[model samples]
Target: QLEPLPALTPEFLCVLNDVCVKCYTDFAPDELEVSVREHILQDLEGFVRRQFSGARLRLFGSSKNGFGFRQSDLDICMVLDGQDTMDDIDCITIIESLARLLKKHPDLKNILPITTAKVPIVKFYHVRTGLEGDISLYNTLALHNTHLLATYGAFDNRVKILCYVMKVFAKVCDIGDASRGSLSSYAYTLMVLFFLQQRNPPVIPVLQEIYDAQKKPEVLVDGWNVYFYDDLKTLPSRWSEYGGNTESVGELWLGLLRFYTEDFDFREHVICIRQRARLTTFNKQWTSKYIVIEDPFDLNHNLGAGLSRKMTNFIMKAFINGRTVFGTPIKVLSPIYPNQVE
Candidate 1:
């Protein structure tokens, strides 16, 4: 059993809030940095078009998502002008050729084609800007996912702060690199959104669950519905619970740590953001994984499906330690992690 937490003093809560806000201010990229990514994308598209004339690229992931850091990657999704989709074999073939094509470019180096990943990508390093990027073919679902996350991040300022804090925490704990056998920064962002949606008098509404007609509208992408209530101008009227929960960013950050470690039932429930109702692990037939995070649009995809037994334990322990460190009322708190809790 986890040890009981002490009552949080108001002064410490103030400190916690400051730390959460600082996470965003310190890590977020400025406008000039954002424009450099766009320039890179434009230049890459022009270069790739020399070989594949119809190639069109658009930035997604943290690049387009609101909760991006200065050093975050450029997730570019490439699609053909005439063709709508490509089979796995076609994708791999294109990626392999793309790698060779990129290697010939003067500015790009380390052109590796990762055909084994769920989405095949041609990874490259932009020498001038020192930014790493990957181009995936027909990543339509990811484009939608980026929009969904951006919508949430724009809905509330507090949401963005908490997500930044969560991502920072995950990176500090060495549990946010999906390429390194852990969850991605995207997964951590989804977890923050799920917690906010599940909070009492929810901080944010379930975007996918809100609709006008008797039935929800369908916006299909890659055979999955990508529709959500994105009209933020009138969201106050649409979501009855809008602006209901006015908790500070610091409180929400600590609450999120506690929610995952103490309240969330990893064995029984799945971290789903598409709807407000709790989804069971058994319902998804994903009882095999201890931490099941259902992709908002892609129902078959579980973000935590890649975690090993040891990694899951490691992730949980990090959260448990985070909960204890943040929950206790102490005179001094480390800026980020628990180890420096002086």
Candidate 2:
């Protein structure tokens, strides 16, 4: 039998809260940057309209999900009506054409169409705003994933704060970029959500379970069920039984680090928050990986599939260090060095 963990005191909670609030404010994108990014999206939408009529371009990822940082890259997904499968469509030709069209715009630079990539995308740089973005065709699953994250962010303020703090920590430690064989910001957000959901007195309810109870309409995207309770109005009634936890944002943050470092069994269990139940690595057949973060919409997609063993060790070391730092009292001053004595 395991003993209950020690409770955080009010004084320590206040200190952690202050640190979280400051970190969130410092990392969040400014109003000007948000407006500029929106304008760029609109301009791109117009460009897409001129060529591919009846097509829609929408924003996804951190920029639209409320987890974006000051310098986060924008992820756009293009959905064109009457297109069913990639087999019927020549994505490379379409991407190449879009690249040529975007090149005409003086404000858009470094337009590169990477057709052979797993998730083919056309990357570009916005000269005017100094921001980067990528456009992928028919990545509708990402849109639903974005909405899910947004709903989670709105469900609890602490979710967003802790997520932002962790994202910043990942950046500072240089292990946040998935393209470089490390975890993505989205994966980090999922890790935080999983920790919160699995807490002793869970901070939030399992959203998918709530949705299932309501018998809400089903949404199937690319053969995967993408349904979830997204209405904030009805959420109160659903989560009334769970009530609210008195844990501070700081306590939750520290708990997140400690949970990942000390408690979680990465080898045996999957980091899944879509359901209230625990999923095994054996069930998912993801045993060979260091971490398994399932994409809610795309069941086959593992967000942590790209993470290498070396990178996993680096991330674990960082988490352990973070847990030690945040889980204990901080030293306000450093000892004086004898070599620097005047």
| C-alpha RMSD by candidate, in order | 2.0, 4.2
| Candidate 2 lDDT, 163-194, residue by residue in tens | 99889889989989888989988899999888
Residue-level lDDT tens digits of model 1 in 59-150:
99999988999889889999999998999999999999999999999999888999998899999999998899999999999999999999
Worst 10-residue stretch by lDDT in candidate 1? 333-342
Using lDDT as the measure, which candidate wins? Answer: 1
State how far residue 13 of model 1 sits from its true place (Å): 0.6
Compared with the true structure, all predictions reach lDDT values of 0.92, 0.82
Give model 2's TM-score versus the native structure. 0.91
Per TM-score, the best of the predicted structures is 1
